[model samples]
Target: MSVESTETNPLRALSPQDLRAHAAEALTRARERSVALTSVDDEDLVRQHSKLMSPLVWDLAHIGSQEELWLVRDVGGREALRPDIDDIYDAFQHARADRPALPLLGPEEARKYVREVREKSFDILETVPLQGRRLTEDAFAFGMITQHEQQHDETMLATHQLRKGDPVLHAPAPPSSRSGPLPAEVFVPGGAFTMGTSAEPWALDNERPAHEVAVEAFFIDTAPVTCGAYAEFLDSGGYEDPRWWSERGWAYRSEHGIDAPRFWKREQDGWWRTRFGVYEKVPAAEPVVHVSFHEAEAYAAWAGRRLPTEPEWEKAARFDPATGRSRRFPWGDEEPTPDHANLGQRHLRPAEVGAYPAGVSPLGVHQLIGDVWEWTSSGFEAYPGFAAFPYKEYSEVFFGGDYRILRGGSFGTDAAAIRGTFRNWDHPIRRQIFSGFRCARDARPSEVA
Candidate 1:
């Protein structure tokens, strides 16, 4: 149906029957996609594009191993079909560029592994009740695994397009702000509001049991801080300000000597950045992507603003229902269109801020649901009533300290996987994904005078 509605009511709340059906559908899709590999030659297989992503072969294996690891090993089947799975396909364990080629399962072997894992996962889906304690844990883990594989599938498509160097018209972007400055601000009159979403069946350990949080009224930039805006901060020596950076952020900057955005290079005339394996001059109005939290904070401080707290951001995005909170997405229950947000490989890059006024949140915030994952002031920690599901490794591993919370979605986000309720978190120093920030303010009480 609608984009927002679909995202809000994704199969996360599915019955075991639903899970089984979805798994079957996904398996069929994955297997069909596996056949397409025959078309890609050796020349296409080894072509390295982004430093962050691996080759197409690695991606396929990783997805297979993922289904095997979560569904077969952890769920219905106690045994792993591919015992050497971790050594062969652990994407997190080794960088694609640094590590040698994997054991390289032939097309037949890969298909076998994929089939076995799919069957076993489906078996669990059929029998396991989707409600109980262990089921909750197992389902979330599989859910994450599923969403993750879906992400890689999109990446596979990008890599193919990059290898072919497709025409830009086929991948047109959101309206540009090259015409002029974007809208000034979107104000949210804040109050006590529930933060996070958990009423549904399968929420990540990070977004658990929705909790009530209070936020002061404040104004947030209608769009994410743009490259042109951030460039001004750098030109004015924003990085040199100790007041702007946290201790760890400063150390990271100094050690790496990060003077500008990760993809940027200074030219005699102006700054330029690489996009999808090609270098292009920086567009002033486009939302800044590929920025670390440290860079966002430095720019915010330079502008005399601050990043919104996760609660503040949540309040801006979700509309509380009288019976219980239920605003599916920012622009309401409709699915995303080109006019609402830049998502689902529509642009495959950040667009100018405030381009989608129609997608503005109830509080008037623009692009809160997409363009890029916006960094918040809050760290990645559990909500008040948080509990660990079967997947203890999901969010608990990085609690109390290192991880930072980012609300909203990005271009890479699946249309079905994004909602006002969805929460994505990452470590502060990490900057590989498409992420940026919007500024928020701490409202002050009016004086008696």
Candidate 2:
């Protein structure tokens, strides 16, 4: 069997028998991982590595609180395990910078509290039939909880990256793509393709109410823009040139004195990046990671291309000309395996481009599912006929022009949390989170095949 599952019905785990097994395994896996990752010493766990991130201990408790809130209380109608901590763990109630100052559970105490919550969540999972109620129909709540835990795990890993210390986490290097030179770009035929999911069993509220978007034919990079490519932008003074940037982006770049991707610096010989405590020469072939949406847009403009719009991105990543249905992932309906993409923290960094030939989109776009969260040209907004589910806090509140949309998962993103239509958004200036981009160009009438 594969290390990770081929989640045919990714959200609910497919059949009732499978749902029971999957849910039990998923819940246990999440719990074990939560404990394992928080095992860092007490001070480090509670310390806020970056202003943008919550302390490691907070995430540990928050995951447990969320599981209990959703699975234990909402689905099973159980009493709150600890109602007092609700506000402390409530993501919206407090900002990340303020979290460490709030009264929080210590590492050991957090482990104990979460384990007890896990016991009750298991009780609910074992007894609850996968039927009735919108939340339970496809076991959506359990899937949501699993994805939620995984998302936080990734965030905690990012915190580790920002910490000032020797490496606390390490993994074997990614498998070599061993791919030599390859095509620069692939042409995606123009037309209307379904852009969102209506039937995806585990899709979030933001991805609901499937709609068709008409996109003109365009050319997209075969692989993500690599560090080598980004270096040219830096060398050519891409940042110094205002022509490549929007007025706002230029202002942010100039105000912050930003000149290169975050975490990058020149070390005599060439550009070097520090990732997860290991400082090394930037891998020229690896897809560039940790760039912001604004930096990505500037790079695209420098290359005489623009970031692909959300629909154009989806069509390239999901649409298959031979089949009229959109696939759950870039590769197909099956869930992720190591051979398909670098996901679930299996690799400490992204694989070199062209490594995952099996993970390419039907239109031949490489690395569309992983390596880095690719920036898009769209703003965060609801789809036509969109409706928030279970709660509006999940997606409805964040809808607006203030946030830009990013597609595809990064190397640290878990398989359970990402798909072809999965949507992630953040303010344009934030770059600490794993992010990168690919360039696209409008296909002229003569360029269409």
Candidate 3:
């Protein structure tokens, strides 16, 4: 919350009503997420779906407690609604595997809690002006909370995928691939481009202090590596080949006995994938998901290429050669819509690579904003002059090589939590997350545009 740049306010220009509306919509989305996955009995909600994720009940109340912490107590200057229960919802205090043992609010009580918090948060939304403090500036705290909830929504969705119960959630299948020949790779004539955001109102602290980076010209997959391409790799023993993998990646692959992407099963005819308990033939045209950073890197090496660095990914996603400027999204500064990206849990799976032509980046990199979180080669690190705002846990503490950065976002990610510069990170061995990658290779001098 320190003094920032002399940038004009992105939120101050917004009317109080617009802020209220945005806040309300976020709350509604939170509720929908709750209802969508937690519709089952209380036992199911309380049961830990995976060792890596908390029970549904914990996520529900945690979402409410966060809203209350930031909006009600911090912004509204109101007293705590239930200070005694704060310890129960403290995420840092308990790991996911240990959360089920804690005394948690049941599904009914958790729902009531979020509803009450939402009402009070709306009251604060009406009166709170766009203040200059980095926490409150540009209505960032509100934006942060919205993004937090939406992010948890994605986490809960992943948890649901791990459950063994009957399918409860549903969505229409993604649109089929557009009929045409798709280029295997697209050339990017890279140069210095602005990388991150300085003035975006809702942008998180990690994506700040926009800086310039010079990347060498390279070629990248026109879209994500498809299931068909990955199946070919698996058939060719990509897992068995040590030459294609890094030291750490090869170790993980051997220890886990991972021969193919998660959720894939070998059938007599072909590979079958389980999506929310429904078994079907793996869609070859769609991007292969549920693979870890190690798998992505291995795939890149196998293809005689490499994973794009975070800067390269950003360049391909945001850099505009004609204008020599970076846009807020792949398309432009405009907010996302159904036609633009496959976000907000609209589809249960990724659309085929050729889909979302409108959402392509300036250089014709398709589906850069959504489908699967595209894994990058860079480790998580802070930009130059990066400052922690609101709290350190949001970004500061995790700045190191342990976590690899993932750009774009998955089909389950909400519009609130994504932008061109927005980043997501995780351990290289974790494949439960919806992730995929495209390859990159150094461009020849003549290939540079």
Candidate 4:
């Protein structure tokens, strides 16, 4: 199915005018990200030595190609703009490491091509009926394209992080405060709550068909595990101890010789980390980031705790006991504000753990929506009644044990693309993305009392 079968829902019927506005905003955001990802010089855009990420130029043109396929060809019923270049831009067709070797478009050519495609997309949007047909109905295809571009924007941001160069991007630091101390952990009084979204208009397929999940009461860290906390783990020989790691995690750690988070190095006096091409002493209060699922799990085990299950993470972030409903964000139904969370690339690093009291959940869990994508102890899988929409590759192909679910959005995540129900998945061993975790534990009878 191309769209969720929700015909009776009026909210899905986004007006043509509104859809046009959204399309324009999304394109503008994508363009801004493109500029952020590449330098003025051509060499930076074409450089593709990083095996983990795509060349910035390829990502630029691929965004345009996706828009053309969905908006121009599918929704507008128009002819292809560059049919011959389709295979080259197809993500599944080529691995990231092999992309640079391919005859991809140059920076200038890519910029021009994307500009032309976006112009056509806008032309189609002005006239196309925003109703009828799964693809065109409620302008789902346009919304999908917008979200797709934003996802690529986040990917390009990751590429920027991977590239070795002076920092090309800058943003004001997140607000800092001396907010008296917070509890070490908060109790998530559990019962049944909707685990996914059935009513959110733009929610993807995997997050559809809201289902009830019952979780036992648990205690979750009020703030994410911090650098100081993780340092304690490392100092206690956490990495060398096999008991703290899963069999696969131990194997991966031993093979890679990983003793701490990626981008971290030891110095004569203390630990340091690289952030946005600048190296500095690790901030003790900020959430430890660039950690993989394995590292998070190992750290939890070392601390005598465990990663929260995906449902537990969602319950903590979105569930409201008063209304018996899940709000669109941790701060309520309103769109994210700067006071709410550290997002939209507003900062190069996460805010201090206890900083965003305004963004705290009803249960007093802080920074649940934005800061870092929190690793959960759940495999990526389709919810019951889930159906593939538009394409199987989006979510269907990745349903398995190989990938893990990470809830919430990172500091680099675009506010437009993130919601309470948004689910991000990556291989367990992958650490390049901004990832961290909070510890959770079963609430014993005495603790609850």
| lDDT per residue as tens, model 4, 130-177 | 766777766677767877888888788787788787777788877774
Every model's TM-score: 0.79, 0.96, 0.96, 0.95
Provide the overall lDDT of each model, using Cα atoms, as 2-decimal numbers.
0.69, 0.87, 0.86, 0.85
Q: Give per-residue CA lDDT, model 3, range 1-449, as digits (tens).
A: 11124223335566767766776787677668766777778888999989999999899899999999998999889999988789888888889999999989889998899889988987887788766566666667888898998898899999888888678889998887663667888888867888887877788889987887899899888999999999999889898999999999999899989988999999999999988878889999999999999999998899899999999999998877777778878888778899889999999999998888888889988889889998998999999999998789889999995999999999999988898889999998888899998889999977865
* Candidate closest to the true structure, highest TM-score: 2
Q: Lowest-lDDT window of 10 residues in candidate 3?
A: 1-10
Model 1, span 1-449: residue lDDT tens:
11223235556556567766765565555455444542456545555655556677677777878777776776655687778767768655777675335556755565566767777776777676555655544355556666666567655755553443533323666676432455667666655666666654445666767666766778778778888888888778877777888788889999989888777888988889767656789988888887888888878887888988888787777654332343666777555677777776666677777678778776666788778888998887778878876556656766877777887888766654566767777778766777889898766565111
- Model 1 residue 316 CA deviation (Å) reads 1.3
Off by over 4 Å in 3: 1-13
Model 1 segments beyond 4 Å from truth? 1-56, 72-80, 86-112, 115-142, 151-170, 175-182, 240-243, 320-326, 333-339, 447-449
Q: Rank the candidates by TM-score, best first.
A: 2, 3, 4, 1
114-212 in candidate 2: lDDT tens per residue? Answer: 888888988898888789788987778998999899889888888888999798887999987656677999999987777787777878999987777
Worst 10 residues of 4 by lDDT: 1-10
- The TM-score measured for candidate 1 stands at 0.79
Candidate 2 whole-model C-alpha lDDT, 0 to 1: 0.87
